[model samples]
Target: MTTTSPQIVASADGTPIAYESMGDGPPVILIGGAFNDRTTVAALAATLAPHVTAVVYDRRGRGDSGDNADTFAVEREIEDLAALIAAAGGRASLFGHSSGGILALEATAQGLPVERLAVYETPFVVDGLRPLPAEGTAEQIRAFVAKERRDEAVRLFLTEQVAVPAGMVDGMQASPAWPFLVGLAHTLPYDVAVCGADLALPADRLAKIGVPTLTMAGGASPAWFPAAAQAVAGAIPGASYLTVAGQDHGVLHNPDALREPLLTFLR
Candidate 1:
């Protein structure tokens, strides 16, 4: 389950997408959530490596990936994946976290060659327990990034949009992960675009996903996460659902709890 150094593949539009693949089995690309690059999902990728060919990649505008487009659109991200899948012999399973989950679903719904799909804590605001992002939140984040205020952008996105408590964000800022979050802040708008401003689920797209799908949430997460995950599973006909006990949104860092479910589903 070991991996070689990272490599590059030219995505559609010639954007060089950096990725690393571990093991040898049915390929499963791991799409990381907002404020995350490939390294953020390294733990989960390693966990699944022995069971599946886990592919971890840096999405455009983050890590070593090239951002060729002037405007950030979800379709471009899909095309980046399209290229990656093509490299994986034209078909591969997918695993996305949070906003990355939304992107993966969109790719599958749009008729990509996805063999299977699994998403954790997709984070749609299905229930009314929490308020949606205020209008222009995305714009504000974009402005912060444009102004080279990466730290500010990260704080705003986490506290205001992702609903992480302010104090929690303060602690995160002091953690080692804070540097990565700040480094990837320029891509926050790409995440915001994937997760619509209101954080509403796209029922039409979910209905179009015909592949086997697994939607999961952490039991320890706020009440709305499981609700959102269930709604996602319910939307895709015959999709499976799970709530991993004692896990939460930060499960990416300590993802051993996900190994069994991921192996059972994607293997």
Candidate 2:
């Protein structure tokens, strides 16, 4: 049955966390990666709506969510997610992409009442796959945002952090919405911190993760991303891993390509 989406004003760390809910089934909360808002992954929610309830939210400082002057941290993000899950009536499955995947892993580690999880390409960098940016880039990005040069900061992040092709970066630079694209560049560090220390966590820590799990990677995704997904799957007991054909870190942009695989695995 079709259901209209409604915004829920949830409180997290005194900031208003804006979220949207749709469908009616076992709740499935969708958390987006850095700089992406609730609507950014709306397509994926629509695809999942028929089989499972999908709750999508804007993390603090992005989309309709409120921002705080305090430095951003993964712990704060976990709280934001907890509030959303509480608003959803306590327990729900989780699907996270990129940085969002790391957030899901952390939530599960802390035992957040998630029934199951599907984590896609967290970019943990555990095996020297993709190197982090040089020391000065973070400072440079902060400066760009402080000067209100959002696009330039975003360009640096895409070209340096995500390692998107130079041509693609060049193309996006000329797009009319480049400014908005970079508006959240200040949040890049949050993604980096989530995957910091090369994500070299010991296996014993993951062994205690007593929940059904699905680790996903994009078939056409970069090798580094698949590597991290594989690492995560291998570390967790009884976790299943799969790659969605023709999907990438931008899976929300190609929801139809991933929906079937995701539904089959999660359900």
Candidate 3:
């Protein structure tokens, strides 16, 4: 079987953003954490595609999208999302995970025409959310990527930063895809950037957002991530917060546990 290529759209800054479509229903856009491309999110898309029209895209600099050599800012990514939503018929329900959640919140903050928002583990550094692993975390990740220890980088990211259980990390490290994840690991800093100042918005700033928002965190996820989710939930008005039992940051890949709550919110 052949996969259709993602459609390219020009963002506000004129950078190209790539996106793909599947299924038929109210349009839903799937935004991934840093370093994740549409292919990595195929499983989640497959589940949602059968229900709602699912649009998955490569955030700039990865997959089929254009890249800026100087490293684009988080605001630029928000614009990229806006362009994609516009292409999806001028409005879309956004479902973002990790750093993508950060983008979703920022987009909502900027008053984009998003209909609804569902976010998972956005890593907002509020309420004692654990700080990034020291100052050299980004540098260490770069070194791993440089040595082509891509799988190693992914492992470190999942285990150390993502707070994945040690047992799960050990098992995943043995998988063949670990190498691919590591190769893309260098993009970790981009995810951090996407989060911007991490709930830096003032009270009035957050109160201005009126989109129906759903903030989700995995019950088994680290305390910090859930704290971050709560922070986001508190900031937005009328946003409902829920915890998905037995789910984690990677719940997007584990749709059996995630789809119901997600569809319920987005649909």
Candidate 4:
């Protein structure tokens, strides 16, 4: 499972979405969370490629994907996923992480032709384990990006929206990945929209999703993570729920632990 030639498809609004596909058999698209680009899930894509056709792509405002920022809408991103699905042979399974997970759920609810679906820590707030995102949080992120304070935008999203510890955020800034995350700061609002400002589990919308689904979280993550995953699973009838042992929000960087679990559900 190696990197393949990059591909691009025009979304409903004619925004070009760049993606790469590897392996064969049934197709499964991998959608990353906030600040992620296609490269963020490249390793996970590679791990799953041996079992299925794994497609990884840039969301609207990230990586090589073109964004219509003036007309940004969650529907546009759904349309983007629709185009990717069409390219994925009219229908495909989906595996989404964090905000991307929420996006996948929204797409399914909006009537996208997805097969089996899997989401990890969709980041919903349930039972008040974590407070809902404050109103105008997305606007604040947009304002930061507008002022070219990309680092501030990233920090705000991680600390306020994602609830990452300030110390951990500081550690991240010293890491090489911080720059890449900052480079995608403009998309933080898009992720916010994907999760919604309220951050409540969209139970009514999720009820519309009838496909076989899998919801998961890391055992080591904050209590809210599992609660959010469970709430999502409960909303989607018959959805399976599991907590990946010894894992946390950073599971994206450790694809191996997820390989078998995903392949089990995927196959």
Candidate 5:
């Protein structure tokens, strides 16, 4: 197995972002979604390492990254990605999954020097297929996290925000990954902020992303995923859309399913 030492870069706010880089081609950063840290995307990074210099980093307040503030804002997260892009030789491609995809789009809208962008199954509610978060959901999550009710916070996010079935959430809670989910429960608000309260597709904002872009969904994913992906692709001028065969929102777990399309689009 190929291995590399982790590195740290200071964001504009002076928060330290922990990351690892491998391979020797054009730079590509992997941004994982809710409940994920850098480790969750390491396999995908490794799969792309041979063809591109892949950088996987922990988003703020997760894994090895420094958490400098209790308040979560999307701008700060965008600055973190900007700092990583600077570290990746001033400009690089970005690949974000789920809420992280929303963040990437916001970054591009905010004028980050992104060369190419790829996103997988960003959960935007264009057709009202998924329920939008209730007003003040971020504050509610903040209160739960502040009280250290980690399990409750996690449950609220999964069932309410992500719209996972209660029984499925219970099954996940029984799994070994549940504890890790609890550990990162505080960062759920960050994801919520990135996705926004409305959860509607920001067609006007996405249209401003004047870069080569690829939006991907999974054939076996929930009905809303492809719709969201297609909506996003259509919003961004000249952006390409793809559906990974026999995969779902958890396509990151099956790196092989993502590797080819990523290579084809990114190259």
Candidate 6:
């Protein structure tokens, strides 16, 4: 496995974001979804290293990154990506999964200098497939995190925000990954902030992103994912949509499934 020690970059807000780089080609930054840090995509980075300089980083407040602010905003996260791009020589392709996909799209909309962008199953609810969060859902999640009710925060996020079934949540809670989920539960509100309260596709904003873009979903992902991916792709002018066969939302867990398509698109 290719491995490298993490390096730090200061975001515009002065928060330190930790990232590690591997390989020797055009840079590609990997932005992980909720409950994920730099390590979550380390294997994918390693797999892509031979073709591109893959940089995987912890978003602020997770893993080795430092978060000093009392509040979370999507702008800060965007700035974090901006900093990573700067560290990657000022122009790089971005690959974001889930809420990370939302962040990448928002950053591009805000005029970040991205050469190319790829996103996997960003969870937008364009056709009312899932109801938008209640008006105060972000606040409620923040309160739960403030009270240190990590488990409750995790439960609320999985059940309400992500719409995972109750039985599946119960099963997940009993699994070994439950502890990791709880550990990162405080960032649930950040994820909510990235997706926004509306949970609808920001067609106008997404339409403004003027980069080569690829939006993708897993063939076996939940019913809502393909629609969400398609909606996002359709909203963005010139964006292409793809479905990775025999995969689901956890497709990142199997890096090989993503290797060829990403290489082809990114190259």
For lDDT, the strongest prediction is 5
Whichever of 1 and 4 has more lDDT, that candidate is 1
- Output the better candidate (2/3) by lDDT: 2
Q: Sorted by lDDT, highest first, which candidate order results?
A: 5, 6, 1, 4, 2, 3
TM-scores for every predicted model? 0.96, 0.89, 0.83, 0.96, 0.97, 0.97
**Number of clashing residue pairs, candidate 3:** 1
Query: Candidate 1 residues 1-267, lDDT tens each?
Result: 124467899987999998888877999999998988888888888888887888899899888789999987999999999999988889999999999999999999999999999999997988696888877898999999999999999999998789888999999999997987888899999998898888998987899999999999998999999999999999999999999999999889788998999999986
Cα-based lDDT for every prediction: 0.90, 0.78, 0.77, 0.90, 0.91, 0.91
For every candidate in turn, the CA RMSD to the true structure comes to 1.5, 2.7, 3.2, 1.4, 1.4, 1.3
- List model 5 lDDT by residue over 150-194, tens digit each: 999999888878889999999999999899999999899999889
Model 5 spans with C-alpha error above 4 angstroms: 1-5
User: Compared with the true structure, what per-residue lDDT tens digits does model 6 show for residues 106-129?
Assistant: 999999999999999999986788
Write candidate 3's Cα lDDT for 128-241 as tens digits: 556544455555656776687776777666655665677988887788866667656766656756654333424465577798999899998888778878777888899989
Cα displacement (angstroms), candidate 4, residue 219, comes to: 1.2
Q: Per-prediction count of colliding residue pairs?
A: 0, 0, 1, 0, 0, 0
Q: What is the lDDT of candidate 3?
A: 0.77
Candidate 5 Cα lDDT to native: 0.91
Residue 199, model 6: lDDT of 80
The Cα error of candidate 3 at residue 238, in Å, is 0.5
Compared with the true structure, the alpha-carbon lDDT of candidate 1 equals: 0.90
